[model samples]
Target: MTTAETTGGTTAGVLAARQRSAELEELIRKDPGRFRVLTGDRPTGRLHLGHYFGTLHNRVRLQELGVETFLIIADYQVLTDRDVAERLDEYVEDLVLDYLAAGIDPERTTIFAHSAVPALNQLLLPFLSLVSVAELGRNPTVKDEIAQSRQSAVSGLMFTYPAHQAADILFCKANLVPVGQDQLPHLELTRTIARRFNDRYGNGAAPVFPEPDALLSAAPLLLGTDGAKMSKSRGNAVSLAATADETARLIRGAKTDPERHITYDPAARPEVSSLVLLAALCLGRDPRDVAADIGDKGAAALKATVTEAVNEHLAPIRDRRARYAQDLGYVRRILRDGNEIANEVAQATLDDVRAAMKTLY
Candidate 1:
């Protein structure tokens, strides 16, 4: 089977398994009052389409559900691979701007930079001691990162990233983690650590960490204009903050097939199919219906149609972002308030954790 077939089959199998798993029963048993969700982005670059569809859009939905959400700017995770940490401050600031511009309400949600929270880092040390080095090596995310980087040399911090991630979730006592299918292992590891810590230290007291479960999203995986993965490094990603002219230029230059007529056969014509997907997402129409409406239109006409649809879709978001970008002080104030809220919650969790371990006086 081809890569696409393999991916499709795996997704189907996972869906079938999920339908049978006692997920609903477990959810009821946990009964987390209101979902305390923890999800975050690494401060490596500006948010792009993959980030938007894969997580950010769902985050907006979760927030609307009245779930208590905490968005972390994973600044320290940048050190896992990138050597230079000098410009990290600026990178984190830009990330905060991106979140605000994308409609993540500072008033309703807590947002904080990872490095700014000392308690979260402190939790990491004990969390690391709880898990073994060999176990960390077995984490699927760690393996993927190593393969992606193709690095002969790996850092100890990089190797233990899952533990740090566990710290991020456990430090907030988050009970719901919105994640894609690929991140199930991370959630499992977090649950394992929580169970181990509670068993080891509970001593008739409440558990220090709440085991978080994946709140799976049904969002589609958006592909880049180049028909590859939607990523910044590939130069195919359209930025959330892209200007109107830049957006148009990228759409026009996007790769399409040699056929004079446009159709939405993803398997046969991936490039045209990709454009159709983009147009459907932008216009909130079905891809098949959009393809049919464009019937005999050539690729040029299709490109024009897709461009108009996208620009219309992004115009409001762009305007909102511009307004927020103009007031640097307002953004800073939002982050400051958000940081305070997150820090209070994180410190409370850490204090509980320390007390459980008999380290707190």
Candidate 2:
């Protein structure tokens, strides 16, 4: 289904669904929770609104709710696309800056580079052995990614990305894995590994891995200017770091319907529909309502209005990002402290995992 349909459906179910999720999340929040959270970004490019709305924003919310948040810099995953491998350092730093700029509060969130955590990688071996080749191949995420890449020969790492993700979550003993609807399959695999390890070693004493549930986000998907998926690689994404002029230029260049008059009909007029959606998100109003307010205003006027709204929304974030960027020391200190906390928790989990598997030396 299109994002519009998904948004509409979510709006219908949101009241009850959000109540349940929030209640459960609050339970996890109040206690000195054993329920750890594992969520991250692949360091292929700087993050954009899609990243913000889809996950990062929720991560901030989760942190405030008191879940121990581990933000993984999936640096290794960058190798999935060959072109990105050469620029790994630049990309990793940009990812860090983006996270800091987006109000992640490194003080509250544990941020670490995937490659820096060796013990986590070590867990991959025993974790990998628990799942079969057939099981990995059956994962819908792997299948979709393969189809998207159009590659006949997939990397073992790419095919076993779920396992790596399992290692990421299991290494932190994460009880909650916040994911989009599309990511349920990978979370299922993580749960399987957790259960298997607990059954093998826990001897019914205590659960080693908490089977994580999907903390499905209720946020609307933000489309790119051209009405496709908002991805940095697609050249359609609006970066969090974009200057006012750049944002205005991009919004001005955004595709709109030929109707001249503004209306929000996603199916028939995706371009203008996308603009309306963006305006709503920025202004915190319903897209339909925003369109009605526009009345007979031309698309040009609508785009100009949206451009101003977007810039206004992003200006403070951009300014904050600029300050953090100037002081690399502050950024480093934040990540360093986060990494220390992450490693401490990860080490405990890995120790338990090793003892459970009898891999301890």
Output candidate 1 Cα RMSD: 4.6
lDDT of 2 by residue, 24-133 (tens): 66676677255678899887788888887778788877777777788999888776644337678777778888887878877678899888777888888888888899
The segments of candidate 2 whose C-alpha lies over 4 angstroms from its true place after superposition are 1-34, 150-152
Please report how far candidate 2 places residue 2 from its true position, in Å. Answer: 26
78: Cα error in model 1, Å:
1.0
TM-score of 1: 0.89
Worst 10 residues of 1 by lDDT: 1-10
Cα-based lDDT at residue 342, candidate 2: 69
Clashing pairs in 2: none
